[model samples]
Target: MENITFNHIYTLGNIVFENEIYKHYHYPEMLVRYDSNFLAFKKMPSIDEFKAAFTYLRNYHMKHGQSHVKFTFPENQKPPEGFLEYLNDNDFLYGYNELYEIQPDQFPRLKDNPDININPVTAENLDAFLTLQYTFDEEYGEEFAKQKVALHNRNFKDEQIMQVLAYYRGLPAGSVDIIISEDTAEIDQLSVLDTMQRKGIGGRLQKFVMDHFPQKTIILVADGNDTPREMYQKQNYQYVGFKYECIKVFE
Candidate 1:
């Protein structure tokens, strides 16, 4: 099989990343998806241009009714000369400090992270997961929870929304999902509630997931959670890349 280079994927007709890499073109374009972390990209547009890109991308995904987003930078080189200023002017948020990626191969054992009793959850545990999602949201997602509730009510004989669930101290603590792609698995909706902060419940569950699927590469987006991000780093996963906050504004 031919290796799908990032450039080749652009032949699908997307050229935002490579186009921005060129110094000559000031074309500010972006690629975004909100189902994951919110992220944005663009050439060196003006401060307003950056803001527009930032807002536009976020707005697009918001219309999709996504809850959150994360922006990431892809580079092996040192930080750009004016990267911070550019980000600040554009409302692009980052961590309290520099961010890093984490892997489970390095931190393989869940026994060390925390005592999360992990398992593959099914219809039996759907309601519990929704309850957890209800508490995880900043401003309670009633509508989102309605959507989640509808998900729980699904009775698909042939096809259904796939999910994974984990229990911490015999209660639901975290989860990652099985997505649409056959080969690539998207880690969706991993949450460790505020009441359970600093317990390492999320870590142990993630370890169990990684250990379960050794052949697969895990991809998840971390928000402002330092513990989760730190846990990922201690495990040795480097930041492969990030997506943009995708939004489409009304003309």
Candidate 2:
């Protein structure tokens, strides 16, 4: 696996500000996506600097009708001394994400399943794809789901993106979006229905990517504290790096 830094991670947003310290990304179209609207540090800041930065982010997001503030640290760096304690004292929810990558051949052979079928999203299956995604997005709210569906519709027209849905017994059970680049394909937003868990739907969806992108490295970011990272390790994905991030939501 290559040195998969934050550059390999894709987001649907534009950078609104930048300095030696950090960059601010804002996507007014999707306020629900915290990943698309936040600050990313280029290096660690002192607690006083962090307080000022958080204040700035909090005000910026509030002015835009957002209810949260988020910040991501540079990859492969541990939090500066007292940073986690500062976040904890300030009521921010914090965690890190583990980046994993596997070459096509590195992926182990998965058991063949006759009942599960995977297909790329096309005009014929676009509605099914959107419906399945909306089910997952609706947890935030109906308006957020509608906005996400609109975003997905826009993504469908982009040549660099491929969205796929997994079917079990002819019903949409899971889906994932593949962001294509010259030498890598990153899997984003991989999801399976609550009723469909533990039936290998997620693995089948991943296998679909591995088979289709045999020449490119397949990459994904898993919650470092979550069980899925363990599964990724068991599936032979190499853990490349991690980044610490935290978010605070206001009422």
Candidate 3:
């Protein structure tokens, strides 16, 4: 992947995540919630700035009864010297995530499921979109599901975003969010119901997004340790690079 293009995708994703959190929480500034309550920064601080940043976040969360601290860096970037060791010394658990990308032209031909129809979400179908998302995410527990649905609802108000829902024989079966930038189209929070897996609903939705923004580059991130990255590779997405993530949970 082109390095500039890759960075653009990463920056766009950070903006998308931060915006979603702000809208969901009704906060004025860019902030994110992880593990239910702790707030996180959109961009990683440099090594020299890490301590002050960490202290502030820690104090705010601890004061608010939040018990976790998390930090994520963009691909090919490293945290400040001893950042991981500091977290380790402080009992912070850490991990990493894989970032993936695909050109619309490179996406494989999806098996057209005649029964499935993917459409942009509008006010008329907003409820269906939220319900489908809640169903797919409910396993994460009620609070997470509720927040996710709320995030999507808030994202709908953003002109740069296009929320999609796939219907199988008149029932919502899958959903995804597309964040459109001038040069790229970033796909986020793609989900299909458990019962609808392996039925081509996801691929159909993917194709729908490509068709919707035929000229822009498409990008997404997947868990490095999970099966989804492999699946994305099979669908013609490339494993461009990955970022390291570290988190600490307070006792």
Candidate 4:
């Protein structure tokens, strides 16, 4: 497999600015989605450069009534000297994301459960899908949930995007959005209801992807600090690379 970089990851946001140092992505419709709006640095910068970039993103987000500033550093690159300490001192939350990919043959075959039925989101099941998404998004807040539903509504019309809901015994219990390209199927927003976890619903969802797109490479980004990455590894997904990111949220 070729080396994977952050540039290979799929994103729905539009790039608003790009230069030698960094690129800015913005999706005004989904202000609360950190992945949709962020500054991605191409290289580690001096403290002064970091501050300038932070100020620019902070002011840009504030102008749009957004309360967060996010920055993604170059993939597989260590931060500049004192950068982590600087972020900690300034109350910035920092983490990294591990990118993983798996071929169809590498993915394990999951046992099919009669109780679990996965379906593509369409007119007939859109409400159930939205309900499941809203239930998850509501953790952030009602307003954020509403906005996310609207964004999903827009995404539903896109030909490259496919949202699926996993029903456990006739109830929507898990959901994921797949962004398809010619050679890849990127899985995003995969979640299972807390009440229905540990029942193999998550693996079933991945099996759905494998069954549907057997020829394309399946990829996803996982929080480097989270347990889900461990699950991915156990499921035979290859860890490709990681990118560091930090964010500050205003009250």
Better of 2 and 4 by lDDT: 2
lDDT (tens digit, per residue) of candidate 4 on 1-251: 45555566787689999888889999977888888899989888778988999999999998999999999888898786588999999999998899999997888877768999999999999998999899999999999899998998998999999999999999999999998987888899999999999999999888889989999889999999999999999999999999899999999
lDDT at 60 for candidate 4?
Answer: 92
The global Cα lDDT (0 to 1) of model 1 is 0.46
Instruction: Give candidate 4's error at residue 206 in angstroms.
Output: 0.3
Candidate 2, poorest ten consecutive residues by summed lDDT: 1-10
Give the per-residue lDDT of model 1 (tens digit) for 111-181.
Answer: 45345666665667767766765565425435545554444344212132345667767877766554323
lDDT of 3 by residue, 65-173 (tens): 6655666555566666577677678777676677777788888876656799999999999998888888877786677688677677778998988999999888998
State each model's C-alpha RMSD to the native: 7.8, 1.2, 5.3, 1.2
Tell me the deviation in Å of residue 138 in model 3. Answer: 3.2
- Screening candidate 4 with a backbone cut-off below 3 angstroms (N, C-alpha, C), the clashing residue pairs are none
Each prediction's TM-score versus the true structure: 0.55, 0.97, 0.78, 0.97
Decide which is better by TM-score, 1 or 4. Answer: 4
lDDT of each: 0.46, 0.91, 0.70, 0.90
